[model samples]
Target: MARVLYLGGLGRSGTTLVERLLGELPSVCALGEVVHLWQRDILDDERCGCGARFSACTFWKRVGEQAFNGWGNVDVLRVHALRDLVERTRHIPRLAAGHMPMDEVREYAGFYAKVYNAAAEVSGADVVVDSSKHSALAHVLRWASDVDLRVVHVVRDARGVAYSWTKTVTRPETDGAEEMTRYSPGRSALLWNAHNAAFGLLGRRGVAVRRVRYEEFLTDPRAALIRLADFAGLTLVPDDLNFLRPDHADLGVGHSAAGNPMRFTVGRLPLRRDDAWVAKLPPRQRRMVSAMCGPMLRAYGYPVFTEEA
Candidate 1:
């Protein structure tokens, strides 16, 4: 069983940061959302973390060679279509139960399992950190026969997430062809509620999950990583803790297929909470998010501002 630490949550919730931090560990390999490998990195030939195109990068080329004997055998368009049909958020529960009648999902999961196994073999990693940020996909992988999956359910204050998703940002890898992503406050709130609830259900469904709040993590990252290390059954030595300097991480090239443009970030990283939403977001929008996510927010120890102006 290849150990997989799956980061499950809504987008813009700091999963990428957590994945990158864990990637610093010696025994863990961070594969940035292998789900998007076909479309984003492979077909589009985007920039890798190593600053080379996916196929051109030695690390990913090795991964391709190990996984498929070569990347040529992969049918990008067909696989993309199958993934869209089978990996929808609504399909998560059934997928988690291993009751998927869709042969496409099984086939895809089989392919994904092979990639993860190959990654571990080639990288010599005891664990693989997947910052896919999709509860549905994480659930499906839990039932994979070849992968041992542990989940990190990352939650953030709905207001903060709603604000982040509302802004437009560009990715360096996309050649400005596509913006990062955008969502209405109402939509982000509803999805945030649903995704977090689904991950909680996944834990009850026998998926090993460790819940981490983005706010709490930023407050004390060292403590968070300590808890995460214990949950994932990995060790974190003193050298692996490099939060002191913003340019301290000796990041190496990774064959990550897809994620935020932050994947391109190397050297030192600063840890801080983005609280811009508190002052910048309109009051009505905040109320809407608060109302939609109020109960869950309170349940998770996040404050609700529904009564505010």
Candidate 2:
């Protein structure tokens, strides 16, 4: 069967890095944020910051090779179909809860093997990475019977994520601006909280999940990649990542999400904990994020200095 990995975590938390690095395996193909179900109405919504449309990207092309009956487009239909197949194979009790069993995991693995073989038949890839960082999706993948699944949890400091918004209205990489969450100014903190809350449950279970701190991954990329590759059961050679040009194309460059992935350059570097919030946030906003998420920060080993003091 085809091997699959779940590279998911809090949004804006660095799951992309995991996807890119894992792509090092000849059998591995990583497709970030399959949010088609959430945005079911807009299949041609836009290309990700990676500079490829969800409809015709090289990444999805590889995944399509593994899908049931050569799924033509990576749309709501494909996602729904995949979700249903997983549910049936695994005997998922709650669609919302997303719980599964060992038997289901095996079934899912077998189904994915079919996908991988199909992908190999078409695109010659052996593994697939799905960056649908939602905890519900992650839960299903971890326990489903049809596949062998690995879940990578990525987390960034809440402060760093909050400050990121202040740096620019547009995302650093993806310039597309229509979806910016302006309803709540403090939405980043809420996003950080909700995203983590979902995965925090898995951490408590003490199996099928591993957390990757964004700062740590950035600080020692090669070592981090090696560790990650090892966790996913792949042999890592120095040459595997050289061909990865993070800035190969700019998605969401001109509009609002410009500073996203397109803004991120893939390179060998050390982990960093940026304090952009220190200078960017107003006192009230900073206080609110601190007051609201102080516990989560400490739980992840991040210091909540203001709260302690």
Candidate 3:
């Protein structure tokens, strides 16, 4: 099995940007929203943020097709539990090996592993990036005893997330806190804490994982990705350096009208450490996040709020 990396955080926490930057590697077959909403009409495929259809690309097309064994792509993870043909046999062998099996590497790490690995091989990359952003999937990947897994937990300031949330949600990249039934002003804050916390739990369970700030990744993708590759034990090459290629707009299976989630520039300034959330958030939301995620902020090295922004 190939080295598998998962990018997870509270939604909209820059997973897309991380995917794009990692996709720069010639050896990486970058997958965004592999956990995409495949069941409910594919919520507008519009070229992914990568600029390709969820089911059209030669790589994703196969994964899209194979994931459901011809029933069609189903993005929702729970749906796999409901469907008989969702791909247990497809990955059981790979996942049971207790260590990654190079010859029989299966989807992303098992189930959809082949499609992703095939695509990466096609791209001449030896490593693959699955920016599914679904904690559920991360939970499942945890069961793959065969594959060595690395979880790249991307965290952003609650204020940064809140500010981005205030703006029109560009994509369902993350189901914003307000969108969830369990949402609360403190929800995003706890979420920011929860994502990293889960990684910690996994670590205690003896899982090998690495956590990085979304800001650190963008500030220097080269160092970040290289460090990431090293953590995964994947070999680095020149192709891996092209994470910001303009044509990286290639995307996964979604819908035509959804437009492209992968269309933005390869580089952007890191989220402001001090006043980013301040500049974008309203007083109430700022207060909520500060009050809610305050301890986590301090733990991760952010200054504690004296008074909410």
| lDDT top scorer | 1
Off by over 4 Å in 3: 40-52, 64-124, 170-184, 237-260, 263-275, 306-309
Q: How accurate is candidate 3 locally (lDDT)?
A: 0.55
Task: Give the total clashing residue pairs for model 3.
Answer: 37
Q: In terms of TM-score, how similar is model 1 to the real structure?
A: 0.93
Q: Candidate 1, after superposition: displacement of residue 276 in Å?
A: 0.8
As for TM-score, the candidate ahead, 2 or 3, is 3
Q: Give all TM-scores, in the order shown.
A: 0.93, 0.69, 0.69
Ranking by lDDT: 1, 2, 3
- Relative to the true structure, candidate 2 reaches a TM of 0.69
Better of 1 and 2 by TM-score: 1
lDDT of 1 by residue, 190-255 (tens): 999989998998999887999999988877777788889888898778777754344234455555
Better of 1 and 3 by TM-score: 1
Would you list the rank order by TM-score, best first? 1, 3, 2
C-alpha lDDT values of all predictions: 0.82, 0.56, 0.55
lDDT of 3 at 76: 46
Off by over 4 Å in 2: 24-27, 37-42, 48-66, 70-123, 165-185, 204-207, 241-275, 306-309
